[model samples]
Target: MNRTAPRPSSLACDECRKKHLKCDSTTPPCTRCTNESLLCSYTPSRRGYRRRKTPWDSAKTAAAQKTPQHGGTSTSSFVLGDMDLNQSLPLKPGDTTPPAPSGSGIVPSDAAVFSAEAPTDTPQTIATNRSVELTRQEEERLVHLYYTHFHATAPILVPRKRYATQAYPAHLKAVVHFIGSHYTPAFDSNLLHDAVEVLLSPPQESTLHTTQALLLLSIAQHARAYHVNALATLSRATEMAIELQLHSRDAPVRYGGLDPLLQESVKRTWWEVYCIEGYLAAVHRQPSFRCNSVSLEALLPCEENAYRDGLEEPQSITLDQYDARFFADHSVAFSSACYRIEAIRILARVLALTAATVDGPDDIQSVDNAIVAWKLHLPDDKATAIDRCGDVDQMMLQAFAFMHTATVFLHFPRSELLLRVPTATDIECASAMVPASPTSAQHATKAIVASKELSDLAALPVNKYSPVFTCALVFGCIVQLSACSAHAHSCIVQHRDRVALMTGALKSLRRHWPVAGQALRKLNTIASGIFNPAQSKQSGTSSPTTHDSGIGMDATMGDLCWFDLFPPRNGTEDFTMFGTAHDIWPS
Candidate 1:
């Protein structure tokens, strides 16, 4: 066999360039490449790549918008005060209407050219608006606060600069103000929500803005003690997302020429829908969402910082790459958002397995494998859930929270982990004599260890992450409380204290999040059934705190309406959660 002769070239071969090896500068094959039978070739030099620069006009715009506020967040320059009064019609879900005015508000509206003070959260409010009853300035502040706190963690919305300068229809702005006002002390989100909802016309078109807005509203609705409404909103968002083809691999290309940020936003929006719907399924105790499976083909999001900086990955990694990396030699540094997506997807599967109609062993085993693989495949930076700056990775922590919760849900039935009272999770108990899948001691240990780890995550300041974590804390507490009840040994007291930690975390979250408030009430009831120190010790007649009684939950009751375990809050406003609706709390 005649080998292709080595020929001189101007640069190193591709493989040599990658390895930083000195190449003989050859065509066909370099000397070393020929000896090793390597494909030796070179092309363009990858030099002079620098951080993308903001154009002078954009820079000037950004500079003017960068004025600092409390919490070190910069105000964005979105001119929303003078939007044109054109026939801005809002679209209700499944309705047939055109839409509210659609444009980046930097230059907007047929009736008004509204511009407000750049977004700031310093207890300052500005005035200007036509349809929605929020001032341009208040909208600015709430939107800015949402970007600073919520977006940094979840990141579904546009960048802070882009959001302030450019955004969508009035109803979309309304959904934003609805959530963002929860972070702002000076405004009433409820009134804002009503005002925003009133703008809805009969639904007609399903644009990206409408899809994005519904996603935000669904979770916000859940936060406001409306799980049914949240479920409905999520259903609509899921449908709209599919209608937008957000679940397809080529979804981004389907949109005409979106800039990098918008392209990234397209992917982010779909993943957000999948993750949020998973949360809703767990909260609602329903079947897994169709979106979770539908979005499997789409590429996972790029790095969190890259998305923030408006740099799209030339070739994003697929879920297949993420799953294959565990056995493959090379690895990929997945973004926090990607890991979050994977975690929630598995969580959905875990929930589905627990709710399975068929008594199949393969399903549970497969889900368990996926859960373990998720942890084993976590890259170095993500393993610890903290960054080099010592800041907690909220999204990564959320991913871990989902994974840990999955373990508890998957094994809570088979592991023999005790439960004090009936939890929001309905368990189908296996007979002690002949279990279908024998309850492994390993499974029980995983439940307790997972419970402890969950408490640690709950230790994060409530503001650092989404209030949706309210469900995870409740799940962890159920296991911790059960352990506390099952064992009176000195060791069990630690589990009892962990129960307090989880409960306290929910209480802290409840101040702003109604779902957490409900969870707190439900947890106290569970505690009462388990080993209520106040009730048990004071009454001097303790309930059995052992394996026999603690583990004997009724299998026929099915899943509880997780949030409705306790009755309504009786129109009571928690004082700790409110000094006044408008009192500014710490960021």
Candidate 2:
């Protein structure tokens, strides 16, 4: 039978038809109609035969009609009529029925729905937990990467030996070369971070020996970082070194007989670690932990143990032995000097801070006493001790001079100290030990021993290649001399000319001296300029002329010149020389 096709359902509004692809048809004002531009119409429909209520529906209706077993009572009765299309649904005979709702908006019964479905046998709890754990592990890995690579490079100095067979070592070496060659004040932060990272992440396949080398590089980089207070970086480096040392000790069969190069690298690493630890401790005003003893013990097999007998003697070893390379070979010297300097600096800072805090006589005396003791113990000939140990004999003289000058300044003001030691003049003499300026070729050709010594020092790994360390040495010496000269001027009017001479000499050395040349030329120029300006004038380069004209051919001549230039102010009188001819002469 070809029954008439059902009229195509009319589209409702565009939105509903587009979304559901359903049709609605009701006349205007019809039950489905709306005044808003919604389509409203209903096609004449052939209705399906209505069936009797299903067993579930009959049960649900009966349940709704029955009184609740609980104390609660139904407020309204369910009305039975033409089986409601939304409610009449078939169900199995044994199904426990849910009570029919009295009105629309009734909440679904979860228990009834669960009862209708069979209980599942499997559970997903374990899978859920595993997913969570995996997520956490991933997050932790991300954090580790952020710290080790993003914030700062791990300060892991992988040794060249570790990468001997691989290109990674070469890449790392190149990286270091780039950093060292191009390092500037602006690049310090970034370079430091990269250096630390390279140190921390040596290739996994690297041998223990190579790893130790890389560690050394890391330590050196960290030491450089210390100049700018990258304390956390330095601390990490030290920790890494300690860990590597421990690992090496435990695996002697594999790493026990490390080559001298590795051994030296390890020693230097510990030395720097110890130094940085001490410095950081002192800066924080905490008692520095004694890493020196531990380091010394670790390095004993590799070191000469030169000062074992005099370990208890303060300042027994002169500063001349404190070269950076010495630490590479002789770890004891390195640790000792590192500890000593740290202690000195810390104590000095404490005294200064304390003096500033309290103005009483006792505080001043306490500081003064401490200063005196420090001066007495300062190593002579040891201004740059790490570099001078090789020539202990020659270094001893410089060490002595340094100690004497340090002693004078430690007790007196800068001016009074200058009068006594006049190290600025000595610095000029010391400068003669360096290469002469290009402008002074004639002086450069001079074969002075001091010049040779300075040249040797410049070539040494301890001072020559390390610009940071060298700058520290130069500035330290200048500060000591300047302080002495300043105090000397404050204490004695008669010593004013001597102070001026020292000041002029220091100024000349700092301004004119270059590290490339021998010391003799520098000394000759400085001495001539200070002792005999007329001679310097004849030589073409003007002596650093001073306001106080207390330097000339003789002490008497200088004194007369001083008076002529600076006539006594108010009640002050011109300073007069009172020594024999030799006493008045420049040494």
Candidate 3:
């Protein structure tokens, strides 16, 4: 199906802009209003207006490449000013003039932003980028997508009620647009990422909004495989949050008597920082939880329903109170974010257990026990990953996924399934081994159970999960794939189909996020080694025709899609001859 070319619009009609409807910018009533018998006005029409493009010349290239120096007047980085951000603002009724785009934006290595002729603070062309040309309808759909698909997991930003009316700062707006862009087909994800990166680089005033923007952007960066950038960006966000004292219980009152909705946003932001810090650190096998109870006394987030509706939370629980009282009171409903915080706390314990020299069984068992207790105590409503709306609760799914991942990390070493190859350093499982005990068999069974649970979680119908959940899924899948290579050929046959559950989930998720793509590529490498006996036999030879000539392969098989690990084999052929799947990494 071919899409029709969009009609030329000198300017969006006032009514169409307000309604976020695509308009032809035709004389008098536009097609939308004329068809619907609604009034239309176009006060800001500039009939002969043509958008000017900045030249990507040698001078600009040199300027953009200049490294940052302290107190130096010349730097490649410059903040896109408010005027640039205003290009994103919705057009108002009876407005005499529409906001024009800025003349500049910071350039990234892969793309150019503007020429050196554009002065600093000359608000860059925020209206459109070389690769991003979304119309009003697309923007609304993307924003809708953020709340629908991603926001429930983090649940920081409010809906368009606030955004459509408020004059949000550039960084916040940039992050929002970047997040929403993930779900939009009209834009290049890389261009959007570079644009958002530039928007956040310059020194901006330290405000709660800036802190929130940084936090969201960090998640976005990590989701797209920008690991180092994500870490640095998140560190900056953490420092800004700490500088604002958002970790203190009284920070809101101490700073200002922020309104109820804004207050909840603040609390959510602080806890999110803690959750993400613990999660990323543990995932990377680094043991650090700066926002833990030792220093911060932040409150848990309010219910998602109340927060979304702008209602005041009747009560808020602290970390200590939550541990003591949450299980005792059945009526005390906890938010997914709260459970997620607890999950990270457990993951942190797993990190500690993995780091420590485990001399006895208690070391791993204790962390394993804590995870069990957390699962048993979960409220009946959240016991499963289903919400009241009968939809897959993404945050709840992530919480469970995180819990199961901890279980895997706790037991994968002792699983003792028979793989001799060492995993990547960052992958905690089998990368290093813990001291063995007689209870190692129990740990092996536990690891298998956790991986199975992960497969079930991945089997849920959804395009994506939380970025944290995606990591958990990858880690969990690694354990499952390793199990497929068990010594017993019969067991391998049994578990091979289960592996598809995870591979298919990742295959679908990477379509929406590049983080999963990275994992898939790595996993494909590991898979090729495990499944391709012929390749393993000839250690240093040209690659085989696994891409197209495999027994069960079809032309529709996508790149990096190594889900088809086995084909149907007759009785005569050995099970090992099932063979590896097709190309996973870029050639």
Computed on alpha carbons, the lDDT of every model, listed in order, comes to: 0.59, 0.30, 0.58
CA RMSD, predictions in order? 20.5, 31.4, 16.3
Compute the lDDT for candidate 1.
0.59
Q: After superposition, how far is residue 380 of candidate 2 from its true place, in Å?
A: 16
* Candidate 3 CA-lDDT value: 0.58
lDDT of 2: 0.30
Off by over 4 Å in 1: 1-132, 200-204, 256-258, 293-295, 312-315, 418-437, 528-587
lDDT (10s digit) by residue, model 1, range 279-332: 656544444566765537877788777777777444467889877777888776
Please provide, for model 2 over 413-500, each residue's C-alpha lDDT reduced to its tens digit, 9 standing for 90 to 100: 2122222223324232323222222322221122111122332333232211322122222222222322322333453342333333
lDDT of 3 by residue, 1-587 (tens): 99998744536666675544567867878888899888876543211101122343234435545642111222331223211211221011111111111210110112222332233334442233333444445556766777767787777766446654333454576567678778867656666665565455434446777778888887887787665456556767777777788988876554325466656777888888877877776554453445553465877777776777765533457877678753564466677777877888888877666555433466656777889988888887889888888888767787888788878777776555423212212223322343245665676688789988988888788665776566766666666665654435556554566666677787888877787776776665555554554664466422332321231211122222221121111112222221222122110
Q: TM-score: which is higher, 1 or 3? A: 1
* TM-score to native of every candidate shown: 0.68, 0.30, 0.67
Order of candidate numbers by lDDT, starting with the best: 1, 3, 2
TM-score of decoy 1:
0.68
Better structure of 2 and 3 per lDDT: 3
* Worst 10-residue lDDT window, candidate 1: 578-587
Worst 10 residues of 3 by lDDT: 89-98
